[model samples]
Target: MRSSRARALEATINRLLAGGPKFFVKDHRAVSASGDPLRYPARTQRLDYEAEVAVVIGKGGRDIKSDDFTSHVWGYTLFNDWSVRDNVSFGPDFAYSKNFDTSATIGPWIVVNEGIDPQDIPIECRVNGELRQSGNTHSMVHSFAALGEHLSRDTTLWPGDLIASGTPKGTAVDSSRQETDGSFPDTLFVKPGDVVEVSSTLIGTIRNEVVKPTG
Candidate 1:
């Protein structure tokens, strides 16, 4: 029943536009972004990147029934959920930490959900060009239908809205466990200037650079 800040921010942007905008704003779309590709606000460290197909709502509804989910869905595109992991852990609301300037990057293109099956897409994430996470959409514990219905239980959903199918099992910081070698444990984490890439066979890749905070 809680409101999604991501949705709120999007609505505000659309309201300010002159024409009836037909697109959802994406935060970031590349792992190797260059030439001012839009960045989030300052005060962040350990920016983790994720590869995902962002679902864009075409039709708006409230308390949508599970059986009618298809009617509300519009299209899908790629997204990178750039996580300022450190701040998110310390903040009161995920909005300040997760929904920053360009923290949610989406799309190279929009694929109509009516024509594509969401359950079979191949999604993967790579850091510095190396494969780190891979999984099929079928692996999700919560299906698109379920999520839509659950979210609309007591809230309204609007067109151009976004619903990120949560990342696969291997996405979080402790994606890999037991990477140990006695006294020192060899671990991998995204650092500033590192190229993080996330791709879906259905949508290609969304890439970005991990820049260190400057004071």
Candidate 2:
């Protein structure tokens, strides 16, 4: 993974901690689903879509070994780790910025680990049918099994717990790098009425529309 991507993940952790110690796993409350609308909070100016592969824990365990990851796995799904970019800086309030309702979207459904290889799969994200990000699972800095082993070191993973592997390059942050020919405007953040879809060749597609906060 690029340093930028690592920084993004680390920044999220720091934000969640609110100046406390770094932690890996996320609160399950962050999970959402496809076809659901992502409510945009009035406080932030940027809402970004992150295309990720989610690992659903089928079997519970503690201190699980990497070699045993497949045995303990339930299946896989597509996930979108939506973010409020305006709420992030050198130190972010991830708990507040990321834990908002409908922030993490997953599904289209889970694919059991029969003969599938999670390491080499194509992942993509689109806004209103236009491609915004493209990458592969093989490009991930950390493998899914490694993440499970790391998270289970201190905490016990329960059945139904989801572990979202980090996203690849080509997020909204990369909008600035888009072609300057004026053919298409840069996609900086998701706004109300914008439909975002995340798809994987194996797990299928998860789609969500951005909407104004009802609250």
Candidate 3:
């Protein structure tokens, strides 16, 4: 799938290709959120991993017909939408903050979109090889088709674009709690030296190491 940054660049290129003036805009920039200029911002500290069924768009258009959405889907890939609990809470409605560089760890591989239905897929997340979160794609409040239709209402949909369904009910924080004074250990926030592994019955597993960015 195409990265958000790539999509924006294509927009400028398209305009210029069509004889329009060259006006450039970029969306994906690396920045920290913790208010420490010295400390790089983490979009999530509790950096949870989600096992999501991702749709790769094959065709690009504005106002894509709802019935035709499936035809435009190129395939499916496993996506770990890395979350920064602290950063997501601060702004951009949890979406943009979560879409940072190296934030989107995708594709051990892609499954063709033709044979399987997207909604029936099962998903789960594990920490250090133990199960922490589990759910079926059927539980999603918004289906892929619906999300695509809604998104196309105002914006163009591009090939390689992604529409990640929101995380399921059992993310790390959902299963943990804080003390009365509101303090939590490194466990409360995923710290370095931890391994986050996520899998689905259909898609298999994707694992990542949790580490601190060096100063």
Candidate 4:
């Protein structure tokens, strides 16, 4: 997404060479991202929060041209791709780390794309009212249109599909807190009672409190 564009491209290039993107399908029936507690299925050591800008697809198409991206886009919204990072130990699959119920959240509302300039828009995330991420859409490596083009190459993007742009620097696992051993300190993650908010003037704010999971 636009969020990762600000970082050095070396990491991006290497990631592409590794296997392509780290994507996993979400179980729509189990999604309860907002107005619900952001909880953990188990006692995950690193319950990471990914604040992002989600692109709302209005029309469906396959092999879309980037220049025609605007015609297919419907609107924009906020997204949080919560992750149970340490859970990757099960087998390194996103299904293990990302597909849990309530692991992700989507908007309080949508801002339709009528007279909007998607780029250069401001975005940020905060925990307990403390700012942790601050970046603009200008840094996005790929425009929403470009993402639409690349993503729809193999499959059709139907109406209601959401594409979450990447999270920005200062994310819980961002390099700022990386240890010499290449591990993020335990303090960087979220815990019960933590209030996380992702927002932007172009879109709107979405806040949630972390709580213990229920059966």
lDDT of 4 by residue, 1-215 (tens): 54443464466656644643445666675455566787765758778887788888999999999899878889888888888777364254756677777877888788994587777568898999989888877776666777778889989999999887777777776543556786668787888889999898888888889888777
Q: How high is the lDDT of residue 199 in model 3?
A: 71
Tens-place lDDT per residue, model 3, 41-90, is 34445555556667788898778766778887887766666666663443
Q: Count the backbone clashes (under 3 Å) in each candidate.
A: 7, 2, 6, 2
lDDT of 4 at 95: 68
Single out the weakest 10-residue window by summed lDDT for candidate 3.
Answer: 31-40
Clashing pairs in 4: 2-140, 5-141
Candidate with best TM-score: 4
**Candidate 3 vs. true structure, TM-score:** 0.72
Position 150, candidate 2: lDDT: 77
Candidate 2 error regions (>4 Å)? 1-25, 90-92, 177-187
Error of 3 at 194 (Å): 1.1
lDDT of model 2 at residue 33? 78
Q: Cα lDDT of all candidates, in order?
A: 0.64, 0.78, 0.62, 0.77
Candidate 2 residue lDDT tens string, 53-121: 888899999999888997888898888988776636434476566667788898999898467787887
Best by the lDDT measure: 2
